[model samples]
Target: MDLTIHQNCPSCGAPIELHEADRLIRCPYCEVKNFMVSRGVLRFVLPDRAPENIERSEMFYAPYLRFKGNIYYCKGKHQKYKVVDTTQQGMNARALPPSLGLRPQAMPVSLVTEEIQGTFLRQTVKAKTLLERAALLTVIDSEKIKAPFYHRAYIGESLSCIYLPLYIKDEILYDAVTNKPLASGGSAENMRKSGSGYHPTWTPHFLATLCPQCGDALTGEHDSLILSCHNCHSSWAEQQGKFHSIDWSCVVSAETSMYYLPFWKIRVRSTAFGLETFADFLRITNQPLVIQEKHTEMDLVFWVPSFKLRPSTFLRMGKNITLRQAKIPDGEPKMVQRMHPVTLQRKEAIQSLKSILAGAALNKKKLLPLLPDLSFQPMSTELIYLPFSDKGHDFVQEQTGISLAKSVLHFGRKL
Candidate 1:
């Protein structure tokens, strides 16, 4: 008979049953929610069909850290040269047995549906060392270009994590899920013996939004970095595991019934490449954008979507819009009707904005040589809910009458 192990709640010391797939659990006695942290490292296996004849086979999971982000390099002084490139790579810090003959490949794994079962190989390599090594490799492989001054390389907006499953049987190494032999001719004695116990080495913190003042549940969009407490009529932005109060406003539309979208209203003082104002940006780029003197001091506001969107689409939308202060009516709308379960954070939105600006500057052939230090001063980060009309699979912006496909907005049937 198969035996199941029951673990006690960390908060209340009450016995609780947990499945392998359970990432989060709540204590019934103490009403405390706990997040499952992996001990050592956890990697996901690729979804593939098992071989028909393989009735019983040994399986194991190997660790590989996947890194994704923008790589930037800068060199020189007066006429500086800079390059920013996006990259995704998988790196294996550990030395694999010669018989395995498997090369690490970057691929997405569905953590929710996929079942990861097998012995997890201990990570012998440190995460920091691996990142530095990968960064160095990227720099070395890049096309050689001459710079007049100092050289500096760095990565921005980066995320890294490990993923797994390699199978072995009869001196042949196979992919755990696919059952495809990766290599043959290795002695079975060369591989490490499977251990009987499985334990997590690291813990993942659960993302939860609660009103700081009233201790009530807060609501926000899936991609929102800001959340609002309806009970206390307060709004806050979450950053670095803390929440700060912020000012918010919504555009009042004529439509009686409407849904609001969240956006990050950002303002920044950029000092780079001899550019200071919006007019300067337009003049340098020679774009046909017109700016009046009265609106010159107006902060550069970026209306970034608080929901998930395709990268290309997100950039396009951000580039087309101009920032201006919205005129509010007598009484503002209640926060309860506008808050959503926000998933994206302020840091991520800022990263996207920076990427967009960099790309635009490069394309315009203006300010491409000088690396600017963009100091973003959060004048006020608001959760502005713009009115949108639901048209089945598309949402039409009430003000601009622009119809956006639901898929592009990542607003599936859940909306």
Candidate 2:
């Protein structure tokens, strides 16, 4: 994983050095912050600014992907099936401590977003691999949704590469950022050992706030995934060092003043499982609903919120929507107010959709036997804006008149 990528500072015309481990770098001459981005997997390191009092201390950035999303687990088969549930989960992206018990918890640290300065430990595990390991720990069988599950599971409204500061002093392990002791003796000694060599590097890319296509300054709420370029009349989703064209449509509402909320409307075709229709779902789940011959093969649609909200609330929203009928109306919205930032991207949404379908299918009938295989093919994806009325501390859905508490919205000023 030793990569020597040479780049120049976007702010100043100065050669920027970059090592494989560095995600954010600063220019020594111009003092500009630059971020390292790539289409492939990327790793980031946090700056260590520990106190100078510790006589013997070693600082290094340990990599971890902060995960936030739902976790589903089930065991047994047919009549013996039991213990099926889906709960929100968060996982630390680090190896479990050895028998010495030097477990370090990642806590909040003031990160230098403007300029990061530190030697990063080469990310021995890729984010994708770490996500897989997390899914395995959760006993999830599918792989396609694992990455998305972890990506969406990030505690905050966004996914981040976290590097914790590990300090060793007198054979005692301490969290340098918090100055809290973690473990002593052999565990501390083991953690102090380092094998990854840091090479001299610099940050290459500048954080762009303008539209890459039209060169117009992008306008949107902070951390929003959807950016609009009025010059080109296009909406783009910023993902993985590139701008992707996203299908955006707003619901037509009669209300004069309304805010358009974004939701990932995903249609998926399930194969390798017999639960393909409403009747099949009812039969498999043993629901009391009467089976009708007209209910044949049907595609599963998921309306996942793009903004951050409580896990329970989000799950409820996903279950309340009806597929196929939730299409976004054609034409531009008169005035769409962007509320919270979109935390989930399209790829992650697809992965999450797969997991959601699998979880629903598996947990539907504990008494039913397990399927031989489970797979999903995405039929269509769109970023649909649903109109909502901001009513003081709550939001009322324009179409359905359903009301939601303001606390459910993770971002934006209190209404």
Candidate 3:
């Protein structure tokens, strides 16, 4: 599929085309880089192939919501999940196709700009409705209605509004791009009367990448959610289109290293569960290790990777790191290079809170009932980089015994 999106460089006003996954825009003409920020879900449109006679302003289009994410659901005594990637119509228009099918993967798409004016179909369908439907569409079994599914969460979610080209000719609805007859309305005239036109009000917004504390240029990969400044040794994350400094530290050693992987260190407060201290965790999860007096003073922190990976690997890494969190010491305020991009955000990492808790539990019978009442509210969050010793096949963090396959690192980048 053509996922190339075009945007004008803020420095030189030169048109630059980028992949859909790219957030950092680089302008070749001006040799400047800026980060793109969006307050809501990103938007895109399919390439139009209509005849030249059609007026661009008067044309009609259909809206589809595209969802690509990892799904986690807690049902009965067990937790289940799947990696889902699908799309559905964004409105209740019966005249158009219910789903976008494989069209987005088959062809190219562009960012919907103010330059294109058309009767963009109104998105009356709620995104929550589609999110529920996507899970059922890709199920392990034709799951029967067993009710009372206590928890459901989506992580690493990539939501976008995709517009399909459409038009009316001779009182009949037709796909403007493929010229195939569509199922929308009995006739073209009926669709125009029934369908409400949507006015384009939002455009993609970009921000200059500069350190808030120091007058230094921020550096990060194309899809990085966290950008850092080497001069000031500061890290930044975006919240509602604004960049904010993050509480970050690095476990630096005197020896040379290859790369540092970022992780989210989260401390959660629960009114129903006693999860504040390491002693509480030992009792809750029923660990074999003896709980010492020091364990009560040590606060428990959930360590989640700040990058995407396969579901199994993601869960394993999170569970293992969290279990040995006490082994990690207070880090130094130092700058580091050769780091993996933070593809996953703090919001997405929090979705795995329950899943990681469930995974860490030794006795499900005791923990299952508590899962319904347990509410994990993040009291504090910090970004930390851990040094890993590179083996030929895997990278090992000797302090915590956290080992990640080199192959897994390469595979995660694609996700």
Candidate 4:
């Protein structure tokens, strides 16, 4: 469902196009990068194909919400992953198609602009509802997996609203893109009352990538969700339409990191479960080592990779980091020249907590019973960048002894 979004560079006023998921806007003309600050859900429109002489007032837009991401679930002892990339009608009116089909994929789209002459139909369907439907549409085959217990999580999701243009001609509703008359949906009147005219409030806006602590420009790749400031030696992530200072750290290692891979260090206060401390985790997971005083004294925190990777690597990487969190010495947070882009947002990382816990547990049958009641009350979170040696085909972190294939990283970017 990813599509190109046309934008004008704030620096040079030169037009630049970026994928819908991209947050960083790099100008080819000016050669300067700026972060795209969006206050609400990103909105894009399908180019219309109404008759050239048609008046602008005859056109109106229908809304569709697209959900793209990965869903991970634990069934008994088996961990499975499902890919979901689907679109649903964003409006309540049944007259319109339930989906735009492959229109969005086949045609070019433009970011909604205030200058548009047509009206935008209000999006009546909540994103949560659409996402639920998408989950159901892409659910893993229940017949194949024989687990009585199941817990699922959605991560790395990209949510956006796309508008389909329609036109009214000769008192008949017509698809603006194809100029085809409506098959069954009644006259244009039904479409008009779908909602109050859609407003520009949902349009994505841009903000300068300036460090709030120090007015220096922040830096990150187009898809990087977390941006770093070299001047302040700190990191910031977009939260609720604004920049929030992220508590981050870097572990010093003998091997210079080719890419300081970022990982989310999250501590959760679980209800109806004894998962609050490292000792509890050790006991529940049936660790080979006998529980000791030091283990009990250590707080339990999960380390989740802040980037996309293969399902196997994702679980292994998170487990390896969590197992060694206590030993991974605290080091100063430094922004390296070649830091890996954080593709996964913090909330998305949190969604995988329960799944990771399930993967780490020794006995799935015992752990599955406690999952429904395991409420993750996040106490605190931090971004920890670990030094990873650049192996020819993969990345190896000596401290954690975790290796990630370069192909996994490359394929994840496309995801």
Question: Which ten-residue region of model 2 has the weakest summed lDDT?
Answer: 78-87
Clashes of each: 22, 10, 5, 0
| lDDT, candidates in the order shown | 0.48, 0.49, 0.79, 0.79
Select the stronger candidate by TM-score from 2 and 4. Answer: 4
Candidate 3 per-residue lDDT over residues 7-90, each given as its tens digit: 677788888877767887778899898898875777788888887887787577677998888887766566677878888888
Clashes of 4: 0
TM-scores for all candidates: the values are 0.60, 0.61, 0.92, 0.92
Candidate 3 ranges with C-alpha deviation above 4 Å: 137-148, 183-190, 193-201
Clashing residue pairs in candidate 2 are 17-201, 17-202, 18-201, 18-202, 67-153, 67-154, 68-152, 68-153, 68-154, 69-153
Query: What are the per-residue Cα lDDT tens digits for candidate 4 across 1-415?
Result: 5686677677887878788668888899988877777767788898888898888875788889988888787666666777777888887765678888887777778878776776778778899898778656435455576665467788887888888888776677888888888755454566665534546676666777889999999988889888889998988888767888989988766655467788999988774566778888877777687878988888778999999876767887887788777768786877667678999878888989888888787887788767777878788999888888888998888576678888888888877
Off by over 4 Å in 2: 1-66, 74-161, 164-194, 197-204, 271-300, 323-335, 338-340, 354-363, 366-372, 411-415
Put down candidate 2 lDDT per residue, 1-415, tens digits, no spaces: 1223444566786877654334445677896554344433233343344678644224655555543344433333211111111111122323322111112122223222324433344445545554455456544454333322211222222233445666666766666655666766464444445434343232223456566777876556534556666677667764556667677666757776776677787776665547565555455545455565654544455777776454455544654443223333454633355434465567666655433433344353342234324555777887777877989998877776666787667432210
Best by TM-score: 3
How accurate locally is residue 150 in candidate 4, as Cα lDDT from 0 to 100? Answer: 68
